[model samples]
Target: MSYDHISESLTLLQKDWSVDPILVDFMLGKRTDVTDHAVKVGQVIFHIPYITGEKKFILWKCYWPDCHNCCERQGRLPLTSDDLITIGKGLKYQKTSDFVKNETLVATWMESGPSGNNVLMTSVNLKRKIDETESDDGTHIRCRFLDEKGACSMHPNRPGVCYLYPFSSWLENETGRARVHSTYQFTGDCPGFFLEGSLDSMKETLKEYSNTIYDYTMKYTRTTREGFSLTSFV
Candidate 1:
């Protein structure tokens, strides 16, 4: 019933949104080198017709692929600037900038919104470090705190995003509130989470996690939209 350990195992996209047959094979245990390993989860991107509006969310095996392997193959885990700061402070790193370059940290900039005047929205991104010279290579950024074994060096102190992986939440256009769900188009999406009962057991917790991000995103979006204005530039 307690899949807390299991939930912490999932991670983000290794490559871009498009699926990779090779990685798929590796995950599916079809590759020669990775014959023993099998993909326990598949990712599903979908939009829900919520009362607020059509909201999008990605549903995947929150666990499996395991952080150990995920670290070796995937980019750094996504986190907000505040999360990174916490991680840096926990690691006792003097300058967070030293750990990661500005570019490595991906952000969503909403140049303009419905107001039509000018609304900017920034989204956080996860990245890793290959070394001092090679900080981030587009989508290949590595987490500086990732150990050789693919474990987060700064565990427990990680960001909310890290805590809520293989799952996500979004703002409903109708209600303008965050909504979370564990139900997804499970057809062939997540191989790791094959048992519905397992998922059912953790649905409540997953929902909670989903709303957490949703609320965070909503507040962030609201603050950014209200605080910044085009005139501020002039």
Candidate 2:
């Protein structure tokens, strides 16, 4: 799919999402707690401190069914081996014995990023599995962990990419410094960019983190052949 299409889809989602009031208040200093290191909305956070003096936030709340559906419609979701195992063991998928142990399933699920880094299929598959599981849209896309409600069955054990959804990490070439980036704004449609209120400073911090993550991912991809894994990003 074109970059434009991806950007548009994310933009639409962003517009529909509402910033958590708890997050807004926390960032605005309306809510204070010495022990408060993160915001929790369905176990989410508006701020996550990775490095000393570096602060990040969950700028956009993950809108469940919509986000899930969008990814399916676009055929861009991915899954990792661990995700497969978790779903299989959880009794979420039928015929788990046949599919989970199949090495060919492993090979077919592999994906390569723009940097030629390889990763396992946790979401979309180009080669459709000839079974009731695969979608007929030609993308062969199916998230095995996705529940009937459109929520991830393995939400807690989801991959790093899922944790950093609508966001990416990058690394600087010269300083070797890392940063975070918001895919929403980079793609140019996050309403969070236009949000105005007493939370300006908080939003600015999020922006800084966004940029940092972008560089961090870039540097990470350069040195890591397997690409960023779920545990590492989390």
Candidate 3:
């Protein structure tokens, strides 16, 4: 929870993370990009851009994550009435008959920055923790539909930020060569991660339309919030 705790965690993973020009700048607290932008890893680039981390978490990463890139640290996704309906229907939570009755009990969703916050973020900010909680910031709360056993029953509909984890990249150097730049270097309790393919190969793996989808996803998020988090769910 202290600043050094975040920085120290990242420093521990010294060899694991690979750096690129863009990532290096962000990690160094220089320039930065929104999480939606594509990151150049190795020869290929990933559509998952520099999504933001938590503010305290960002402080941890900035000083710790051992990230030398200047990519944006944390972000929150916005919520729409449609998203609430889709999520509620998908999770079968507070059913249609109960939805109208209980809907008012919950706000459809709350907005923060580029990444949408979940209940988890809320509890943490308030010093409360719940295994079933969604990631949250102090501002809003977004809940994930759970399964019978209480797992993410509707992960496919999970927020874009949730999907793009431990994944961030940027065009480094003036040439902007795409690459598998920064790896998760946090020594914190973050889980393990590995790109399915080499950073370079992953870039070439995308289809034409896939790139379009990637670009569109980045459009809505803006650099509204400025704090960062150093925690990694991985």
TM-score between model 2 and native: 0.40
What is the Cα-based lDDT of residue 40 in candidate 1?
20
Better of 1 and 3 by lDDT: 1
TM-score of each predicted structure versus truth: 0.46, 0.40, 0.33
Candidate 2 lDDT score at position 97 = 52
CA lDDT of every candidate: 0.40, 0.40, 0.33
Model 2 accuracy (lDDT, Cα)? 0.40
TM-score of model 1 relative to the true fold? 0.46
lDDT of 3 at 36: 37
Q: Tens-digit lDDT track for model 2 on 62-143?
A: 3454556433432333334444455455545566454454411322244334245664433322122334234343242555
The candidate maximizing TM-score is: 1
Mind giving the per-residue lDDT tens digits that candidate 1 earns over 106-140? 44333332234554334445445533232332233
Q: Looking at candidate 2, what is the lDDT of residue 201?
A: 51
Q: In candidate 3, which residue ranges exceed 4 Å CA deviation?
A: 1-5, 8-82, 92-151, 168-199, 204-234
Minimal lDDT window, size 10, model 1: 35-44
